[model samples]
Target: MAAWFLYREGHLFPCYFYQTTGFYCLGCGGSRAVLALMHGNFTDALRYNAFVILLLPFLAYFLLSMLIETICGRRILRRPKLPGWAWICFALVAAAFTILRNLPFMPRL
Candidate 1:
């Protein structure tokens, strides 16, 4: 996957959701976003999918923490524990992004 994105300048897969629904889903721009990120275009990456950019840091932290724990037999970086309120807020934001992106007035990804 990394090599494909590094060498290819376009989407890695077609979005079936968009094809069937005629509307962009939450994951619609994810592939393009990753591709843009691979090319060092942060702005374009965000434009393609802000949600993915936002989640990357948290995901990276969790993955790194897990890998370190496995290799060294110790939890050096504790997994982040988000409060219930934080989770609710994140859910709301994600839902809002989905709704906004699918709206006719909003720009299509």
Candidate 2:
């Protein structure tokens, strides 16, 4: 449904952070990336937002695991508990991606 809306409407919403700061946020181009992925355009999706592309699998796994556990009253897969350092690393990666995507030398995300 979201992909359909994006297909019909072009863009879902402007990134207020980017608009105000003239800098791409971590979520910049995320919607377009999703739309591109839905259309089976892997390269375009990655170009739109490499961070989102790379993270989607983990996000999908987490959500699917949660849903499965909720519905079945047991986990189909073991839920891996991320340590504090892992979260910090993830945050650092996000910050780096945000900065890199906005760099003049980098391709537009």
Candidate 3:
């Protein structure tokens, strides 16, 4: 799992999401954001999607929880979903990120 997470082929997927949908959705910046994160490029990641930079911890926690669940036949404590308020915050943040990144404000990636 770790190897799969870290390995790369230096190739881009078809990105059917963008090609078909025509709207750079919530996760459009994710791949670039993660690549920036791996290279210690905090500014670049934040520029791509500040929410991604901030949510990485929670994401890691969820992944680890899933791994634990698979390894041990039960969830350690039943990973709970974020509260409604957090969902609101996430929506707001994502909206702002998407608007900001897509605009001419971000010209250099």
Candidate 4:
């Protein structure tokens, strides 16, 4: 669905966050990023959403691991144990990124 979000140059749905707050959210450029990635424009994709680029590897790994586990019908993919604090830290970082990405100086493209 994401890969084809922009197929055939159809209209894009407006982002309610930006419409209401007049500020860009961390996911403001996600559509553009996906489109760019589909077109094989790595640099453009990162320019559109650096956070997406940063998380791509982890997402791919997790997806792959899940697929393998599903295919084997067993617990073959074991995720490393993360301390509670690690999750908290991740939440904090995500919140910070959301705030920082909304700044006027940050490129919302």
Leading candidate by lDDT: 2
Global Cα lDDT for candidate 1: 0.85
Residue-level lDDT for 25 in candidate 1? 79
| Clashes (N, CA, C under 3 Å) per candidate | 0, 0, 0, 0
Query: TM-score for all predictions?
Result: 0.85, 0.86, 0.67, 0.77
Better of 1 and 2 by TM-score: 2
* lDDT (Cα, tens digit) per residue for candidate 4, span 1-109: 6446585453257789989988777777777776777778989988887787778788888888889988998768776778999999988987888888877887756
> Model 1, 77: alpha-carbon shift in Å?
0.6
Q: Candidate 3 residues 13-98, lDDT tens each?
A: 44577788665666766667777777788998887667767889988889899999999989995688789999898789888876
lDDT agreement of model 4 with the native: 0.77
After superposition, candidate 2 runs with Cα above 4 Å error? 1-4
Model 1 misplaced regions, further than 4 Å:
1-9
> Per-residue lDDT of 1-109 in model 1, one digit per residue for the tens?
6648645757667889899989887888887887788789999999999998888898888989999999999999988688999999988998999889988888767
Error of 3 at 94 (Å): 1.6
Clashing pairs in 3: none
Q: Show pairs that collide, candidate 1.
A: none
* Order of candidate numbers by TM-score, starting with the best: 2, 1, 4, 3
Worst 10-residue stretch by lDDT in candidate 4?
2-11
| Ranking 2 against 3 by lDDT, winner | 2
